[model samples]
Target: MQHPLAYRMRPRNLEEVVGQQHLVGPGKIIKRMVQARLLSSMILYGPPGTGKTSIASAIAGSTKYAFRQLNAATDSKKELQIVAEEAKMSGTVVLLLDEIHRLDKTKQDFLLPLLESGEIILIGATTENPYITINPAIRSRTQIFEVYPLTPHDIQTALLRALKDKERGLGNYQVHLTSEALELFTTATAGDLRSSLNGLELAVKSTPSDENQTINIDLKTAEESIQKKTLSADKNGDGHYDVISAFQKSIRGSDTDAALHYLARLLEAGDLKSIIRRLLVTAYEDIGLANPSVCQRTVAACQVADNVGLPEARIPLADVVIELCLSPKSNSGINAIDAALNDIRSGKSGQIPNSLKDTHYKGAQKLQRGQNYHYPHNYPNDWIAQQYLPNQLQGTQYYQPKTNGKYEQALKKTYDRLYQLQNKERGHHDD
Candidate 1:
């Protein structure tokens, strides 16, 4: 029986491997390792179908070392032992352990010594965050490198290679894929070349030949085959957070178009919870104080989006994204809190002043609580120049209010007034 097109199309060497130029490119880390014949156990983490397995195969082929494969979740210990025995016999073996995060204590125990002895070069692949999931024992023994989704151009290059390739690919079939079909085939799979190539194989074999004996595959056929397995956006992968980061940053950068673009991607990924969480955070973290009312509006939009699930949810989300992108941006709110927290964590906080302490109890000035405290309501303008912070952090300033929006401008005026009055009463210069 013939193997799948993806299997047959596995790159035989580094040159054949598509994309991942950061690692496998000229003079890159992986390339350097291959050239020096000094390979180490490594974990490749990224979304599915981004050439994790292909990179392992390419490395083995390039080094002319024996390559083996096993699944950390499915394969038995006996299978691992067999591979270990083969490694002993062959002196060295390149083992691709898929789903390395699922590796149990038992399997890991068996592999650790072998990895130490340099008998097995384990290339563990996973779509999960290895730092969070993998055991420290395994992590300490290996380096972790991240892979990324292939670009549309990279996907197109692989598809064309499959079309012309005869021995491993479907070259014998007289197939004619239109430019539109080719574009859809390369792009719809979301950087998964395996899906596109196999979809091409299916399209070629299933589509009947025309009067000219040429199997014609159009955009419709491409859509059917490729979209059947919509990789369901690996939200747990780094790619998900990357899009969220981009979304928030775009809003922070005031690029409405880029912000909406990333928002569309996140919404399409089907995780309303993550999208909402990111939006709420962006409002306070990035747009803080500058446009205070926008924060409440963001909350309202999020409520609406949460109440009505996706497709329709996109409507409210779009409105919030546009508003946030155009809103005056400030990080003063988050920065002030973070700075105060740092002081608290560093033990700079002193005891609360007795005068400012609680006075609602029945002690009746025995401990002098609230003795000298002046009620702000009794003072003019409902404010008083009193020391609220601890004696140690006397003149510490935390909230550096920004004059980005009208609301914050008004706030800054009041803050400046209070600072001047407080500094004079405390016998300190305005800082």
Candidate 2:
């Protein structure tokens, strides 16, 4: 017996394939290719249940070309060779490779000679970003068609047809979908049509068959099946945005424990790489001179993530998040530099003072550029006050070191020495 879901709703033709109208609509690139019989190797990229399989099957059914299917998730290179042998004998072949991203680079490369020789036309399918997941050589030769999420109206129409279409649908059942209940289902499914239909099938199966024949589906039944009530602490979507906002606030407010808790929540939700990246940025931008070593450890965690790649990597990322949160916080350097840059972009372009500009070029000495530039190493204590910035901004201060770390402690003493030199120069001028 056929799977109930597959039996009831497989599209038999291009006209029957729903969504992705951009690719399949009249006179569109893919539609014209199908009609012209000039289709090239391509990859169908999208989330699951967005009709990648259905579109490939429709192409096979509608076109006269020989269609062969291989799943990269299960098939080995040997199995692929068998298909290639058959295709070589045949003049034309359409080889549909599903979950193609799961195949390792070597297995993916096995198709290069065949693709170049025109032994087979390839159609690859994947859910992940093909640029990151596919072999670069294989990717270069194929066209990429993007599938999109189905609209709620399209899903509702499909559900209505499933209820009444006699031969292949649930014609025997009298299913009543309340308006609010339908909206709830649409919202919960997140554009995955297969999950939506499967839930509808289950709801129909579970509803009692009786003389009253009134099947009521409310929000609760829909929620239970889809698990829509669970809250995610992820950072990509709305929940992530909210959670990260709270985490940043905790850090800014100096609540180490609260910041660490939110960081832990993000790590638990499989967002360690992203968490590590943020911590790296925060260490430099927020914890700068206050705790410079925090930046070093955060960068080390990023390297660790590249090395370990998973649940094992989560430990390093979590350690960095906690350490950065507890490290002393300061924004003096961040504020000062940003203020300077903002002035530059907003029509405050400052010229590089002649003293700071390199004077290695021929005849540079004739113009007196770099003529009086101080060599700090030649002076006692290896320090000198010089006009480094533009003449207009000569005395402007941009990097004010914080006092919470060892580097900052040494910086304060140097700053005091520099201040004394400036006052001494002023006193000599008055004399």
Candidate 3:
């Protein structure tokens, strides 16, 4: 009762843990390890409140191993020595080392032997990337797994459980959470379950009970408790993907206003990398062939946006998004390339024509390579009727051009004329 709601609601076993299904789900690596009683040292890295600590605690709980906690930066060698001695006495102990990236060489050297002896199973946790921040010695000794932020659904599950659990949760108090209030708590804290639980506890404790003697947490109370942020969408949340999808679809559908609206949301979220990636993809896939130059300009705009960062970045991003929405749309380039790839993947290719084979070597002429090949530059218009495609795909066509814009229209004309000339030349040979 004295502990924080988050601490009280901590998963006592693996089954009680929320989120990180990839690591804790049935048949997953971690679960398999626990089932077989074969636990190894592992480093779990990801955003805060993503169940890194929960996973470690769950493993220790499930295996009935003694769990010890320590912070690599704050704790001294004496503390580690104490944990090591306990592991020796207990046979096996699960040690959770937080902020592992801050561990200096001195502490690392002391812990390495304990990890190897199988006496202390180290579970290192950090918000930084292990590959870049962690020492190779520690890294090589431990397995690495990335945990993800809790989705709104995952957070909701934990919140509901906390409310109903009479022992560890607020089941003793007759509390009613408005749906709006519940939603605010789940999303407002970005995916930090600890923060969400803390907010829920705050709302429950601060709000006065009504005449019914029941505590009612409304939307306003929830807002004050968690403080609805300017950026409503967490980069890891479903809302983030929704906005990005809307942004790309708006541009593709030629809705300038809608595209701009979604762009503003993403900018507010401060997700510059996602915005840039989506814009470039939209330019190439949606506006391609129709306006080749526009695609080039889009790349430049994305580069500028990346360089400038934020408020100023919004300027170039807005400019390109508007232009992309107003520009003519075509999928012909992507369509054509995919069509060629499909053919090649389906075993449509054949040997290169002898006349078209490379003539870089001395004996290539003896093999009739390039002997009969008509060089396009030697002919009018720098083009000629030649067998360029593999023999089996001699007349196969792939580049289906579009007439959505003047550029593609011109390309279609050129493609059709060349194909006709080549067909006509083949017809003469057939005769």
Candidate 4:
């Protein structure tokens, strides 16, 4: 049985590995480790087709060790024990465990002794972050290295190499790929070399050779082989938080276009809860007092979105997103509260003013709690000159409203007037 082109084109050694120059390049960490023949157990992590498995395979080939492959998702404890026994007999076996994050306690426990004894030189591969998914004991035993996505140029180089290599690749077939077809493969896969190679192979094998004995693959064929790349997202994964962060930042930065783009991505991913939550957070955290009405509108929009889920939910979501993107922004409300909380946390919470203390309880008059308190409603403008904060924080201003929007501007005027009246009263009393 013939293996897939992607498998056949796997880099046999470190030298043939196309991407991840940071790790496998000359004098790099992995290369140096390979050259010194002092290989240690390590975790290789990154996006798919970025050569996590290939790097493990290349390292095994370079060191001339007995290489064993196992999938953590399907392989059982018995299989792991078999690998461990082989490692014990071989003195040192390079075990390439794919989806290493999926390895349960049983398999991990079975491999721990072998790993510690230096019999199994484990090279674990994972698409998820090892720190988050793998056992901490296993993580501590290995040096973690992240293999980034292959660059377009790097992927293109791999494709060309596969096309010309006859032993394992499609060199025997005369395949003519137009520039447009090549672009479709390169750009559409988004730096996934495995997808690119498989698409190329499908394009070549499916199309029959003409009378001239040549297979001409066009742009349409390439697209059909590797459909348009779907946006890489996991609603419960890092991509979820990442997109929401981008959406909020775009709105804060006043970039309507970017905000809409991120919103569209989240909506397409069907993460309605995240969209509604982020919109509410962005409204208060970013728009804040600068445009307080935005908070109300955003809340209403969220209600609408919740009532009518996606497809139609996107309408209200777009409304809120656009309004927020164009709205005046302020962080002062949150900043003021955080500053006050910090002060309180630092043990600066002075006693509440005597007059401001609650007087509804029994024996309140005997304690003289409300003795000097003047009702503001009894005075003009329903306001009175009195200390609302403790003595230590009497004159300390927390909410310094900005004049960015009309609402805050009017608020600033009222706030300034109250302070002015209080200062005048204090001056008169001092005289």
Of models 3 and 4, which has the larger TM-score?
4
Query: Candidate 3 lDDT, tens digit per residue, 1-431?
Result: 39989888988888999999899999999999999999999999977777888899999999999998999999999999999999988789999999999999999999999999999999999977788889999999999999877989999999999999999998888899999999999998768888899889998889889898899999999989885443335786544776799899999999999999999989888999999999999999999999999999999999999999988999988999999999999998888889889988998878888887889998887888887888789988898886778867767787888899999999999999989999889879769
Residue pairs with backbone atoms closer than 3 Å in model 2 (clashes)? 234-240, 235-240
Residue range 1-431, candidate 1, lDDT tens digits: 98889889999999999999999999999999999999999999988788999999999999999999999999999999999999888789999999999999999999999999999999999988888899999999998999987988998899889889989998888888999999898788878878888888888988999999999998888887776433337677766777888888899999999998888888778889988999999999999899989999999999999998878999999999999999998999999999999999999999898878887879858989898888999988898887887888887889999988988999999988888788788875334
Error of 3 at 67 (Å): 1.2
Q: Model 2 over residues 224-305: C-alpha lDDT tens digits?
A: 5553421233244444655677877777666778887777667667676666666666777788877777788879888998
User: Once all C-alphas are superposed, what RMSD does model 4 give against the true structure?
Assistant: 3.3
RMSD in order of candidates: 2.6, 11.3, 8.4, 3.3
Clashes of each: 0, 2, 0, 0
Best by TM-score: 1
In order, the Cα lDDT scores of the candidates are: 0.90, 0.74, 0.90, 0.87
In the range 1-431, model 4's lDDT, one tens digit per residue, is 99999999887789999989999999999999999998889999877778988898889888899888999999999988898778767679999999999998988888888788889999999878787899998998999999877887898888889989999999999989999998788777757889999999999999999999999999988988985543445676654576788999999999999999999988878889988988888899988999998899999999999998879999988988999999988888998899899889988879887887789999988887877889999988898897777767766778888888888889899988888888778668669
* Candidate 2 wrongly placed segments (more than 4 Å): 4-8, 64-66, 85-91, 117-119, 212-216, 227-431
TM-score of each: 0.92, 0.58, 0.63, 0.85
Please rank every candidate by TM-score, starting with the best. Answer: 1, 4, 3, 2
